[model samples]
Target: MIEHATHQKIALITGANKGIGRAAAEQLAALGMTVLIGARDPRRGEEAAAALRAAGGNAHQVTLDVTDQATARAAAQQIDERFGHLDVLINNAGITGSGQVSPEDAHDQVPSSVNLDMVRAVFETNVFGVIAVTNAMLPLLRRSPAPRIVNVSSAAGSLTIASDPDGPLTGLPTSAAYTPSKTALNALTVQYANELRKNGFLVNAADPGYVDTEINNHSGYLTVAQGAAALVRLATLGADGPTGGFFSEDGPVPW
Candidate 1:
């Protein structure tokens, strides 16, 4: 059982073993928050925690698979027993069904030929997983004086951008599975924010920009730190910060 100073803010980041999630954890820890690295693999999670600790950050590992209900509940229970409260929750676990962003690879995701099973798989992790993890952690988050929930979303999730002829997403040959899943996540973010607004909970969705992460097969131009900036900003929002909005590093993203 790892323990942290009671006064330190505790943050849990899912899919934190690598990619943008890992970058967010490191940055949050640098701000003196006790970051809980949540990953499906215990070994990888422990290693990530160890890396953060070696860098003089207060970090711990929590075995969490966002798509698995049992794991989500168990992780919440562990956090509840250990910290008694949670200050920040960053739902960063997500997947791009095709595993790559190349046009050739994404060709299979076109509306006509796309597999419904693949779409379900994408939603399982990107949409339902966020709901599962958020519901499980709400109890702990509610105990915080200023609770913040950051849903790691994507620019592709914006219906306005997808429809705009001049938008970056307009001409991209993306899949229905990944893109729609993010759209659903963005919608979920708004609903959750609306429901929790009066409770002093700030729930917002963040578009991490195009980062060269495993999800994109390193096709994105932005670095992990660049991608994680908006998420970290949303997670550490002040009491007066805006909620129920979609934001990118540059600023507000069209719904």
Candidate 2:
């Protein structure tokens, strides 16, 4: 295996070619971590890595498609060959199940009339994909001195918030796809944290509040940097940081 600096932290972020994932990579890279930009498209991934390098950050590209286990395994093998171990994992790939439609026009996602196929697709990427990637990389992560896993979740996944009568999402249309997938992801995050805690792993879910990205067709009010803050914070948390919990920029998010 190729050797890297033993003291330097290495991070892999899926869907890091743009949006919140890329922003989180930028922050991590700025903090002196070698960031790996994981994208389904090789060209896009290379472009993003090159951009980060140009900006004076250590970056690399890894072809990753969370929905495909073959690609996940290949990514793991590649990382093992190059870095020998992985210090951080940011499972950030996700979908809104609305296609190219705007949030306000996502009537098709209404629980009563939502497409089962769309829901499955969303879960394939957001929930199951995380499991695939995490399991594949667990061996490499195990080699790190302080392994950290951060699952990029959303506030919509908070059942307590959605159920509140006067909550911020009170007026939003009922969702049956994207939102539920994130809820499942949140649960999965906690399970992983519980299972890996004895190994000194800091695993947590981050609720990146609404950000202007392709997921919502730029309808969100927050910037990408703002959306990525919670993720970066959790990935670099101290050993005393909370595990098996959901948090946002403000503080803990009710699950």
Candidate 3:
């Protein structure tokens, strides 16, 4: 355990080596919080953290593979030993089982053809992983006066949007794997928020707005910063901020 001042807020973001996660980390660090770049690869995590430091931010690297319980526990332990408490936890690590989120790829993800193993793998990272990391970090988060947990979800997870005949989501293919995992994540976000609300822990889901990340094969229209905006906002929410809700930069998103 390393000794540090208790006044400083500490944040840990998973899958932060690149894309929206990295962007969110940089933005949060700019706000004066110590940001931990949690990545599955130690080298990449350290590289990202180094880049943040070079840019004048209080940043560090933590090797964290969200799907692995041991790594999640180790990350929590590291934070506990060094920061003593966690002010923010952003569950940004996720995957689209389909290689590319293209219209062609969408056809392969339809219920009948989608591989059950692929769906399980997607849920392992997006859903179960969130549970593992959040549970491991809860004790540290509870130490904060105003703890925040932001789960990075997607508009594709919204049942309202998916069910609408004239909605934007209606054009997309039915995704049995990626989409459902995010929907489950949204449910988890609400459950956690409801349970932790009395304790002043704000848990919410963030829709990153179809960013041009590797997950989408850089085909998305939004920029990384644009996608990260809602995430940073949720992570830095005040005590009076809404919890157990889904939101995007435009405002509240449907459940």
Q: Pick the candidate with the highest lDDT.
A: 2
Better of 1 and 2 by TM-score: 2
Estimate the TM-score of every prediction: 0.94, 0.96, 0.95
The root-mean-square deviation over C-alpha atoms between each candidate and the true structure, in angstroms, is 2.5, 2.0, 2.3
Give the residue spans of candidate 1 off by over 4 A: 1-6, 99-107
Q: Among all windows of ten consecutive residues in candidate 2, which has the lowest summed lDDT?
A: 98-107
**Candidate 3 collision pairs:** none
What are the runs in model 3 whose C-alpha is more than 4 Å off?
A: 99-107
lDDT of 3 by residue, 1-255 (tens): 554565688999999999999999999999999999999999999999999999999999999999999999999998989888999999999988875334445437899878777788899999999999999999999988889999999999999998899999877778899999989999999999899989999999999898998887899999999999999999999888999999999999998
The CA lDDT of each predicted structure is: 0.91, 0.94, 0.92
Candidate number with the higher lDDT (2 or 3) = 2
Ranking by lDDT: 2, 3, 1
- What is the lDDT, from 0 to 100, of the residue 14 in candidate 3? 97
Global Cα lDDT for candidate 1: 0.91
Score candidate 2 by TM-score against the native: 0.96
The candidate, 2 or 3, that scores higher on TM-score is 2
C-alpha lDDT of candidate 3 relative to the true structure: 0.92
Off by over 4 Å in 2: 100-106
lDDT string for model 2 (105-182, tens) is: 455778887778788888999999999999999999999999999999999999999899999999888889988998
